[model samples]
Target: MSLRKKIADSEAVLNWVARRIAGYARRVYRNTKWQRVGFEELDRLADAGEPVVVVLWHQRLVMSPFLYPLDKGRICTITSAARAGSMVGRVQHLLGMDTIAMSSHKRHVALSREVLAMTKQGVSIGIAADGPRGPERVLSTVPLIWARTTGKRVFCMTYSVKHGREASSWDRMLLPRVWGNEGVFLCKEWPHQVPRKATEEQTEELRLSLEVAMNDLTAEADRMVGRAPWEPRAK
Candidate 1:
């Protein structure tokens, strides 16, 4: 067999194993004792068939599959075009979530169209606001852009675990311990409606507001778990 083909096969096997492990993790997370706050508010929106662009910090991405309201409807998230993004997307798929494969630096228009269409179909869009690559908790304009284009409310959610490890990565990604006490905080939907023709200044204002809301929720979650507020590693 050729060296390239052998390498490809090895990678395929590794990805398969990773997916299976992640699937088990998802099951464990689902069965974890998670204490939720403000879920009713989010449920009310779901019950009313109102689509939302769910935003959270990149650090919280690890708990996404279990944290989101998957029972309400389909949830879609954007994944980058890189190899790691592909692997992450596969894991997300294994957890019954859909992924849009695109990068922040390319094919944004296509990404926007897909997100808008999904929201229109009542699929809640999930975004690690500082993801695909990030300056940690800094918010990306993608969610705001989607909200403005689709006129959907953007909701922020965050969580922390009493027993977990923090990765030595850019986002200090949280790895929830099995059977850990997870504290989830879902903020109320953003009150303002983003106009389709929102100006740059208006969009910046909204983005900053979202960044604060997400950080606040993160802090609240950590406090509930008796942990200090999570700080992203300095780049």
Candidate 2:
């Protein structure tokens, strides 16, 4: 066998092993202590024929799947081609979730198109605003971009555990105990009409509004779990 083929084979094996470890981790992590809040709004949104776009921080990506309504179908999650994402996609499939793998470099024209279609069909969509990779709890413009494109409200979601391990990864990845309490806050977006020549200032202001709303939701979740504002330290 050529050296390149051998290296490719080895890479494939390594990726497979990594995926197994992540899948195991996800199952074990969820079996611990877990609690949920603000789901009523989620169900209500679904009830009102308002297909929503759930925007959450990257750290809480795993928890997002479990927090979603089980009976509802037509839901889509935006993930990536990363190894961790591959693991997540597997778990989501097990839980009956439909996912769409997205690229950070190239925006998929189909993503917006599919989201609009799903919304029209009364299916919900979720975007890990700070994900596919991330800078911890920071917000991204993807959620806003989708909202502007699809004409749907963006539900800003966040969660924290009273006790658990916080991965040192970019998103400070959270592994909440099954007995831990989790909270979801909705930052509903009702986009205004923007001129074809919308100013950068206007765009920045909208983004800032989203950031503030999401941050407040995170803070509220912190309070629910009895912590200081914006401090997701695992106590």
| TM-score attained by model 2 | 0.74
Task: Give lDDT for model 1.
Answer: 0.76
lDDT of each: 0.76, 0.65
In candidate 2, what are the lDDT values of residues 1-235, reduced to their tens digit?
Answer: 9987676457566566646645654664555554556577677776676677777777766656566675754577877766567656656665567777776655677666766777788877778776766665556777767767776666777676565567777776766554534433334343443334457897777767766777777777777677545564464
Query: For each candidate, what TM-score against the reference?
Result: 0.86, 0.74
TM-score of 1: 0.86
Per-residue accuracy of model 1 over 118-209 as CA lDDT, tens digit each: 88788888788988779888888878877777777778887787778887877887877766455554455666777788898998898888
- Stretches off by above 4 angstroms in model 2 are 1-35, 104-107, 178-198, 228-235
Report RMSD (Å) for each prediction in the order shown.
Answer: 2.9, 4.8
Best by lDDT: 1
Task: Return the lDDT, model 2, position 200.
Answer: 81
